[model samples]
Target: MNQSHTYDDVPYPDLCYAYTHPGRIAAIATLLGMQPTPVENCRVLELGCAGGGNLIPMAYGLPNSTFTGIDNSARQIEMAQQKATALGLDNITLQTMDIMEVAPDFGEFDYIIVHGIYAWVPPAVQDQLLAICQQNLAPQGVAYISYNTLPGWHMVLMVREMMQYHTRKVTDPRQRADLARTLINDLVQMIPESENSAYAAFLHTYADMRFDKLGGHTDWEDSALLHDELSEYNTPLYFHQFIEHAAQHGLQYLAEADFTQVMMHDLPENTQLRLQEMAHDTIELEQYLDFVRHQTFRRTLLCHESVDVDRTLRAERIRHLYISSRAVLLADNDGNEYFRTHDGSTFPAEHPLTTAALRYLSQISPRAVRFEPLLKQACARLNLAQPTPEDAHMLAINLLQAFTYSLQMAEMMTCSPDFTIEISERPLASPLARLQVQIAPLISNLRHEQVELDGLSRAVTPFLDGQHTLPMLVDELADMVAAGQLAPSKEHATPEQIRKQLDHDIRYALRWLSRAALLIG
Candidate 1:
């Protein structure tokens, strides 16, 4: 089937969003020791912001932050602008502009996010982006950039070569994707299926996976093939190269978003040991190790040269306590448990014992409790006198991983009230739930009073259209209030009273909107 083509120019926003690496933004923020600035007041810009799928979510997430998205494609810019208007998000501005045209009039921004543009764009445009970063990012601001990397994509290149050669005969993007799939499928069928042919089996297995995923969208197939085919620039660079590049424009690589990825802990022990033995400097080790490992992608955060990245104040800015979920099953051993995660998958508890702990967690719903309390309760429920130090540590790590994955996924998906937790508490429920309870009433009061709440409320209102978490709605609302757009209640509204009022207002708002056919169930 010829998938619908909405426009001639490839939509950058949708493509960018599809391949956006997980945890990149949060990692950049953490490395820069930056906090989430008020969306209503902060100036934010995204270069190569495709159709604004990624930018729109961020614009909606932080109403306190003002957003400007620039794209080379006029059609993509139009789509983004149209969506922004349809959503009534006035805080965002979308313009059709090239990176070469970026100027001072765009204004300095507290944060700049650029994805999928660095590798594909020309060297001159890349230089311009760096110039923009140097001239435009706030003193303490952060820039999030994701690019194609080497080593990991080398294998992918072989596949890409085959696809390109095959697709040269095919004109349609969907057809290209299909031909690519067919080529891989035929290769797989030609190979004998046997355990001895593990390498061949892997290729076929990967082919099957790609085939199953083909032809869903034009942006998806085209971008995937394009990125794969044109990835010499996309491969891993020495940390020094990136550092030097940024330095030319007065920016520096602060840190990586997937800290673990940078740590290279996933590599074989012997290889790591050898690399550690050979490498003398941290930068050299990082660069050489990544090359050896064939690392393909990197989410890096950069900051201006004038910033005191080494100061205690800067260190303090790093966010350590994060909210995550238990989404991976760490261990399957009878008494020992272990788990693994890649990108955005949640940590899942392995056994009934851990499952019970999760159950106890749910009962405490919506309150930020101490970790000790949660551990104590889990121990009691499991009939264990106390959790051993190792046991406690294991659980803590797993839970933290889950929360991090959840937060990243939420951010990437552009979902509301981005759920997170203050790790100091072992809350009865998820920290995300507690945040909602604390903020729901504040939102309701502002809405009822027709107060000009901060951008946050507006950011989160769509998600709150009443079916999801009340806490998320409250967080967004509280952000609006914090931005001074919404007024605090004149009447004394206790938390309970606020909840009651919020519930009533939400119900009424939904009913009225539904009755007017302004909202569809």
Candidate 2:
């Protein structure tokens, strides 16, 4: 089957990737000393943008910015246009276009996204991807590309080989996926874990991971799985080979989109020194790291080869950026407090001012704070007179180290979107999120994070139009239960008890939504 027809037959998942957000792209670009176009007013283009799941939220967040998303699947483009029209979003354009026909003359973009496409396309189309970015990307633009990498894929390819062979005769996509999954689980069950056989261990681990992603149901990501692993054109390349290809097209690697994964902070001192000494350039360093980690997937950022990219992470670079922390402060047995980031890395809360700043970031999290004002507030909290230059450097370096470890976030630009943490008398959420719940439980929040709504929250989201007070919201839920549209938690309850529970649940859902950054003032 042809590529477009395959996608049209089984559409890819409609989901937003936070790391691919222009906000994050610009942030990492700025940290590397490149003058990337600020996301606030930049133009963005997403190739293979399935239904604009990633691009539409961007347009909504950056009202001043313009977006264009093209996919070969007309079905997905139609789906995208429908949602854009429903959202009344005028800044985004979705169209059906073949990858090979996308000429550089189409338009220049400040940021170009080719997510989940490079390795899956034919080699000719992959070369054209680089050609388009080289010719069409703005002078300071960043192009984001994602694909599977080598060494790590060796084992995964083994699994894929087996699955593909087992499902070769199955014509139906969902049935093929089910059969493939059965083969995997069956092998895992048939072979008991043994110290001598690594294959058995790998199968068990892989099966568990699949269960985690698709849940207990074998049919969850039926189309997603069919395209991801069972597709006819899945290819894995080495980081070095991919960069060599990019270099031929006049592009160079800036960094990985997920900076934390490539960091050398966690490496031992001698190991880091050895790797640095073995590699002649940044590209060589990255390739070596890939080999060391046996990396399976990569989300890479690229820029014009002519542009000078400063790889140093200077403290001053963060002075103008916005910072936020989603870490929880924990105390050890000795009462030595440390902050545990969302990803499970722990950093000491040693510096007084730095700790205060992180605490403030946590307090207002999902809401970012500017660097200067944040410093002032931290100093004020510490009851210090003016912050000395040393104090500034100290806080900056500590935060930078933690940021590299993925313990914190710094963004070059952020949008208000008229949302706040405060819950109002008649709470309201972002129109995009409110519209999202009507379709599915996994919705996009203001932060570009995917929020999975619970049953009560999903039921309550559509009603948060800023037109209903607490009593009115409770009445809406009460009426739904009375009309048999919603089921009460208790099988049988008195009317008074149901009313009380409804009031409590509505308030609880609103407060949770407020913290999730879904509420708009």
Candidate 3:
């Protein structure tokens, strides 16, 4: 099949990727002491934006930020156009165009995103993609590109070869996916685990990761298999090699899209010291880290070569940014309290002020709190008259240290605490989210985080239009139970008990929606 028609035959998965959000890209840029285009009023472009899953949510969130997307597959572009129209998004434009034919005079963008396209295209197209980024990017702009990386890709390529061999005679995309999945499962069962057999270990690991992704997304499985795993033009390169190509196009490495993966803070101190001594520069250190971690994939951020990127990150820089935390307060076996994130990273909360700030962020998490106000509140808790720069510096150091361990907390340039957290009499979710759940379980909330809906949440999503009060929502749940659409916990429950259970259930479901970034205001 032709590369352009690959998506036309079997569509690629249409879902928001959290890391590719311009909020995140800009935040990373700002942290490096580069002033990125504020996500709110910037020009954004996406190369190979399939169905606008990534761009549409961004357009929804940042109405002032103009968006343009191009995909070689007309079918995918049409899907994007249809959805963009349906959403009433006037700020975005979708076009069906090839990367090679892109004109330098076409325009400049503050942020350019090339996700899930780099490694799958032919080499000429790949070079053109990078060249376009350099040509079209605005001053101080950031570009995100994801690819299959080397040393790690060594093993993944083996599995890909095996799958391709199995499906060699297959022409239909759907049949190719079926064959690939079946082959992997068969190999999993056929391979025996042993200490010496590394292939068996890698195979089992691959199966587990693949199945984990395949769990609830049959659409994703087929799309990914055909376009990603079984594609003809998949290419993998080392980190340094990719940078060398980018350099020729006047683009340089900015950072990794994932904050946690870029740092060596998680490694043992001696190992970190040793690696630092052995490697010549930041790029070499990264290559060594990739080899050590056995990473199979990467989402790299790039910028114009003329831009100055400060590698030395200072704690004081976060004082002017927004802060959010999902840290859970827990106690140790000795009853000593500490903060832990969803990723299971524990950090000490030593200072009373820092502890207060963290607690506030945790209470209203996913809602970004301003640094100054947070510091004032923390000082107020300590009964201090006013917050000082000293207070900010202290807190920034603590938060920065914790953020390095894991992304339990984050610093962003664009998020605001504008939305109300309390469950109002009439709750409302974005029209986009409400529209999405009716079509599929996967939807992007206002924060651009992808949410997989549970049955109860899915039922409650459409009703969150500020039209239904809390009691009215409870009534809907009761109606669902009565109509047999929703199952009761106990078959023989009385009417009074069921009503009470539903009243509680509706509250819990809606509250979950609020926290999941699904409920807008």
Clashes of 1: 51
Models 1 onward score TM values of 0.61, 0.95, 0.95
Error of 2 at 414 (Å): 5.4
**Candidate 2: misplaced stretches above 4 Å?**
1-5, 192-197, 214-220, 407-418
| Candidate closer to the true structure by lDDT (higher is better), 1 or 3 | 3
Candidate models: Cα lDDT each: 0.54, 0.84, 0.83
Which model, 2 or 3, shows the larger lDDT?
A: 2
Question: Model 3, 364-475: lDDT tens per residue?
Answer: 8878876788888778778888767676788888877766677765545555523556688899988888888987558987776778888888888888998998778878
Q: Once model 2 is optimally superposed onto the true structure by TM-score, how far is the C-alpha of residue 362 displaced, in angstroms?
A: 0.5
Where is model 3 poorest over a 10-residue stretch in terms of lDDT?
410-419
Q: What are the clashing pairs of model 2?
A: none
Predicted structure with the largest lDDT when compared to the true one: 2
A best-first ranking of the candidates according to their lDDT comes to 2, 3, 1
Per-candidate clash tally: 51, 0, 0
The weakest ten consecutive residues by lDDT in model 2 span: 409-418
The TM-score that candidate 1 achieves is 0.61
Which ranges of candidate 3 are over 4 A from the true structure? 1-5, 192-198, 482-484, 492-497
Higher-TM-score candidate of 1 and 2:
2
